[model samples]
Structure formats: structure tokens, C-alpha cells
Target: MTLTLHLDAAGWREHLQSVRNDVPGLVPVAKGNGYGFGLARLAAETSALGVDTLAVGTSLEVDQVRAGGWDGDIVVLTPWSRHDPVATALLGDPQVITTVSRVDDLTTILELNPQARLLAELLTSMKRHGLGRADLPALRSLAPVARFEGWTIHLPMRSPDPLAEARELATAAQAAVEAPVWLSHLPLDDYATLRSELNVEARLRMGTALWLGAPKTRRTTARVLDLHPVRRGERVGYWQRRASRDGWVVVVSGGTANGVALSAPTSAASLKQRAVALATGALDASGHALSPYTIAGRKRSFVEPPHMQSSLVFLPGAAGVAIGDEVPVELRLTTATVDQVVDE
Candidate 1:
């Protein structure tokens, strides 16, 4: 079965504009499989949209925008390191911008190549990596070798009030050198609120909110492949989905290949607090369909466990639905890989 992802470009552009209204400056984040858009296409789109800048996950991503002839500034979000020769080269050129996370890393960058435009990464609670508030002055002290492009702060995801944390970080950013620019990965609502409160101009680094902002922006669909009626107590699939009652075993064309079964726990508490994990110590790579899909514009449920290449849906009364029928997978397409992009 072919995986199909549909994008309503007009819808997305409008969403981007709505998000832009919250923050005066926008830095669209085009990284990590390009949020399933592919980096180059996103770069082109963001460039055309007149964003202040575009941030990528790595130095390698710089080639993506440059190859497309995008003349806008490309910011590398990964923490600075000396080993990143290509990144260093791109920074040496004025075409790229970087985030300085550590005093030593920033020093190495300055020593390796002077005249690098840089944004001082103010450490946040996420604790992934960044220069702590205490270290900011020392790094900023190295003004002889580097020019402070702006200030940056990364907000934690799923926080109750990302705006509050952003405000706190914005307070710390005031200590940084001139030209403060904020980059937030938090929820758009939070970023928008804190952005308005910030004393300095803000650039919200948006990924999911821009590409997968809402269901209205995109749709994913998979076709039904096969179907069979099974009697009670009949076995089906590796899980031996025994029929609790008379129903048809419907085979759908979607599986691990489509990232159907691939999902990490929602949070630590969701996994740790539960006693019986969903598939812990399971006999095979099998599980119920986690992704919701619509059939005939009606919601459908997973009949049994999903197979390796396909999934079996328990279609009790929907036997009237047949093969070649198009079903929309109710999934966040940004998190799912798009096998094909069908417009309209």
C-alpha cells in the first residue's frame, strides 16, 4: 500500500501568517526530515514567505538552502563544537549564523575562525545543552573575537506555561550584548504570549506549529487492501486476534513503514505510572493501530494487532466498506513520513 500525505499550501501559508502576527520577526525551523517537508522545499517556502531567517538542526542542513539558491541567513541550532569543520566554514562565511552554547565551545569557534556571527544560547530548564546564565558574561566577554549576532533561548516542550519560562529567559537575555533575538521551540500559544511581553524583538523558531499547525493544513490517507469475514473464536494475524464476535477482518495498507506503530511514550509519567505497559514483553512486533483513520468520513477502529507490513482493523459492522476505498489516516502528518504529497 502506498502512503499518501496531502498538503494544502494555501491553508499552511495562512497559518504561518497567523502565527507571524504574534511575533514581529519569524525564524522558521526547517530541520529533522524537514518536519516531513524535506529541508529544501521548506527552505524555499520560508524564504519566499519572507521570514527573518531559517534554522536547521545541523551544519549539513546549510547545503540544503544554499543549493536551492536561498540567500537568506541559515542558523544552525545544534550547540557549537570545534569538530564541526563544515559548520565552522559556513560560519566563516557570512551566509550562516550559529548558537554558542558554551564558553569553551564559543572560544574554539572564535579561535578557529574569527568574524563569526553568533547568538549566545542562554541556558534554560530543558537542560539539553547551552551556556548557563553565569557563563554568558564570560562568553560575551570574548567580544574581541566574535560579534554578538543576537541572544537565544530554547523553551521546554509540554510545559504548563511556556510563556512564563520564556519571560524569565527574556529577563536573562537583557544581560546579554545588544541585538537580542529570541528563538522558542515551545508551544505557539506560549511563544506568542511571551513574545509580545519580551522587551526585545523576538523570532519564534517554529516547526510543528508551522508545518503541522492544525488538521486543516494537511491530511494523510491509506487505502484498504483486503478484507475477510471471520467467525467467533477464529484466529487472525500474529497476535491471533480471536474474534470476540462475528466480524470482518479488514487488512489495511499501513504499518511500520508508514510510522504507524512508531511512537514513544507521551511522557515519563504516562509510561512509568502505568503497571501494564501496552506491549511490554510481547511475543511479536504487533499492536493495535495507534493512529486513527477515517473510512467513508466515519471513524474506524483497529480490529486486531498490526502486522509487519500491514494492519488488521476490526470492522464489525463496516463490512459494507470494501477494497480500493480511500481512508484518511487521522495522524499528525508532521510526525509521520510522507510517501507521497498529493495537493488538492
Candidate 2:
């Protein structure tokens, strides 16, 4: 039994190259399941793209990139801290650029490795992590001691006018210290406009859009391990919930361990979406949750919660499925951990 991601190799490569060409100074981000293609695969793809730098979410991922044959620079997106031994250990590596969000962290980093290459992350409206505007003055004083690579700002995805905010922040960062600006979550057109308007070097850190933007280029599927005919009201699965209709207990290869039925907190922005989410939660509470698996051209419902390595989905009546059939699965690639990726 297997859960696999099927990739159109030629189409995927073409898409990657197209994105790379469209976005000037594109830094492919390979972190956190590598956007479902895996870190090593993305690292290898980055090498194939011939990009000078690859950005990871944390310092711990540096070794994975290196092991995947990425000989160029690796930039850790997470802010550097003295408490993180992995981040501290990477300070001396010239090829690794650590993001310094706080002024005091910069000083400590400099004391540890004066020649450490650093990226200054300016605080954006996201307010997640970064050096505040007030901290910029202090940053200027200590920036020269370290190899200051550039400035980075992670813009929020849901904003009225992110370009305007990015322009303002980029301007502020330049005012403090004139350096290249690295950004995230900005559209390609907006990034181009910003680069032209600012007249400064800029790079875009891309993850989802770069890898999984073209959904047609990839497909995820799970192999059907077994199927058992069950009548209505027959108890089955771990919870032993009675079947709602005459159907088959279809066990497929994918579960929580493989990121099936697992979801990150939803950032539902609209009233309708929130209402729909509440409805879904209510259904789940009553044991009528929808499964991601698609059988006979329709999404099925889970008979019960998924097991460690398999899921039992209810297939009502005869739906033309078999023991070794591969059914399509819809899931977030970033959160999925498939057994194999077959590049056709």
C-alpha cells in the first residue's frame, strides 16, 4: 500500500523555469515538507535551476539542502536567536545567511562570529518577527561589523494593499541601510513594479506559488488495500460507528502519519467560509466527516477517523473500485507526507 504524488516531470520543470524567469532574483524556498515535494527534491531542483541562493524556514534544514547537492548559499528565514544552538552554530558559515530581527541579537551574533553574514528582517504589519523601526537605528550601528547581506520583509497574505506596505517598509529599510530587499507573499507584477519604483536590488522568497501553483502538473493518490461489504447499521472501524447505508468499507493507504485528515488552523476570512467551517465541524462532531479520497469520481465520507497508516472510507453501493485501485486524494501538499513521488 502506498500514498504517492505523481508529477509531470517535463511540465513541472517548464513551470519552475517559467516562474524563475518571470520573477527576477527568485529565491526558491525549500522548507517544511518542501511544499510536499520534499526538501531534498526541492534542493536538487534548486541546483538544476542554477540559482545562487536557497531559502529555508529554519537553520536545521541547511544540512538537508547541502546533502541534496545544493552547493550555493542557504538563507534561514526564521529570525536568529542565541538560544537556538543550530542557528548559533551556523553563524560562522559564510554561505549561510541568518536573519537578525533584533538589534541585541545582532550584537550577540557579531560577538560570536563577527564575520557572520546576516539579513535584516524589518517588522511588517504581520508583526510576526522582525526588527522594529525604532531598532533600525541601533541596527545601522552594528550592521557594518557583520556582513550585512540585505533586508527582508514577510508581507501578510491578506492585506488591502500589500505592495503599498512593502514599498513603505522597503523605503524605511533603505533609509536605515541601503541594501537589497528580499520579500515574500507579493505578486510577480507587484514585485516588478516595486523593484522598478525603488530602483534597488530585490528578491522574492517563494514557496507554494513556485512549487504547487500549477495543480494540473501534479496528482496525489492512495492505493486501496482492502474492501469489505457492509450493510446499513453494521458496526465497523475503531469507533465502531454503524454504517449509514449499504456500502463497502474501503481501506486506503494514508492516514495521520501521512498527513491525511490533518489540517492547519484555518484563516477563514469571509463570513460564508466561517459558516461553512462551522457546519463542517458540526458534521464531524456527529461522525459524518468527509474524507479527502475520491472514489468513482466523487469524494467519499470517512467511515471513521483514520488509522495510523490507512483510512476507512465508505463507498456506497457498487462504485467500480477494487483491492488494488489507486484513488485520487485531495490534500494540502505542504502538509502531506507521501510514500513516493513518481515523476513521469
Highest TM-score: give the candidate number. Answer: 2
302-335: candidate 2 lDDT, tens digit per residue: 9998999999999999856999999999878889
Please report, in order, the local distance difference test score of every candidate based on alpha carbons.
0.72, 0.91
Worst 10 residues of 2 by lDDT: 137-146
lDDT accuracy of residue 56 in candidate 2: 96
lDDT of 1 by residue, 240-290 (tens): 767767877777777766667566654545655453453442412354333
Give TM-scores for every candidate, taking all chains together and pairing residue i with residue i: 0.83, 0.98
TM-score of 2: 0.98
